[model samples]
Target: MTPPPPPCLACLLTLLLLAAAAAPPAGAICVPRNPGGHSKPGAPAKPAPPKPKPLTPAAPAPPKLTPMAPGADIVRSLCLKTDYPDLCMSAIAKQPQPQLPVGKRLDGAGVLRLAMGAVRTKAAEAKAAAGALANDPRTQPLARGPLHDCVESFDDIAYSLDQAAKSLAAGDRDTTGTMLDTVRTDVDTCDQGFEEREELTPVMAKHDAELAKLSSNCLAIATAAGLR
Candidate 1:
């Protein structure tokens, strides 16, 4: 048995034990009771990562050119030649053949008017042929040959007619008659040349019939006006 401890020492030891039990142990921090703590109530969760978007492919470009078929070219050529006949017929049909006073001689002005009308008609026909050549696929490639030839011939006829008008305007009867004859010959030659082309045979025939009627009407007018 040991001697009993002092009363003051015993009291101090009891106070030290109570303080140790109330506080946290060494090397540990005291945590407060709050919503952010481990044992707290409702809290927000972390968000998920976003998905990547898909890529789209670009579209291809269109072709630059397309080659024409053989049959298509042939058809286009025929169609182009046909246009010449149609135009020529239209010009002939629309010609104005006015009857003059009986036994009245056509003055320079009167003759010039008549020749100008004829030349205008020929120009219209030639212009139509040129347009047909430009527009028709079949005839576009061959335009330099038969189609161009037709246009050139009509141009020559128009020129001759224009000269006739000029001569008549100048009061030169002899020169006007000569120029008229030349124009008629040129038109006949053009008609013959068009007929020679196998591709233009039908068209030429149709033109010939219409041209014949026009020529006859023109001759009658010239006779009435005392131009012949």
Candidate 2:
């Protein structure tokens, strides 16, 4: 253009033209290929959605029972024959597990076994509860007598129920009935102890209700099994 370029300058210009021809379009951006396929460095980084929290477990449902009858359910079958069918059903169903025996049918003997087991377990629990009350520091010295008596009464009831279970096992229905009845009297005595002092506490009332239910359930079971 201005007197022909020098030889060196001419060679440089030719090289520059060749490089320009090999280049990408002027406005295009170049992105490097990733070897590991990870996300691009500055690409707005699409935020990942947060993970969901785990769900909590549900509580077990209580037993759903119809009116006691001689149909399929063994507990219902036996309880239907008792004086307090509803009470019997509720008490028996409160057990940790109420699975059927070997053949799934509860005969008179089986009824006795189940009832006696329930009675024994409840008697132990009642005795322990009463003992705790007796040992409580919150109770006044004068009011402690009734609670102590209640402890003794529950202990007596426990022993009586154990003996009754043995008599039932020995096939002595009359003796079993006698011991079970004696246990009812002991429960009343426990109540009378608190009543005499006019010191019936909330704890005592709760224990009384639970004890009454368990004892009544045992009595009803005995009646159903023809031990009364």
Top candidate, metric TM-score: 2
Instruction: Provide the lDDT at 86 for model 1.
Output: 40
| Model 2 spans with C-alpha error above 4 angstroms | 1-72, 94-104, 199-202
lDDT of 1 by residue, 133-192 (tens): 646776535333555555665677678667767776676766766766665565566466
lDDT over C-alpha atoms for residue 147 of model 1: 52
All-Cα superposition RMSD per candidate? 18.5, 12.9
Query: How much is 40 displaced in model 2, in angstroms?
Result: 67
User: How do the predictions measure up, each by TM-score?
Assistant: 0.43, 0.60
User: Over all chains combined, what TM-score does candidate 2 have?
Assistant: 0.60
Candidate 1 runs further than 4 Å off = 1-112, 115-119, 140-144, 204-208
lDDT of 2 at 119: 62
Q: Report lDDT (Cα) of residue 49, candidate 2.
A: 97
lDDT: worst 10-residue window of model 2:
65-74
Candidate 1: deviation at residue 59, Å? Answer: 83
Q: Cα miss at 80, model 2 (Å)? A: 2.9
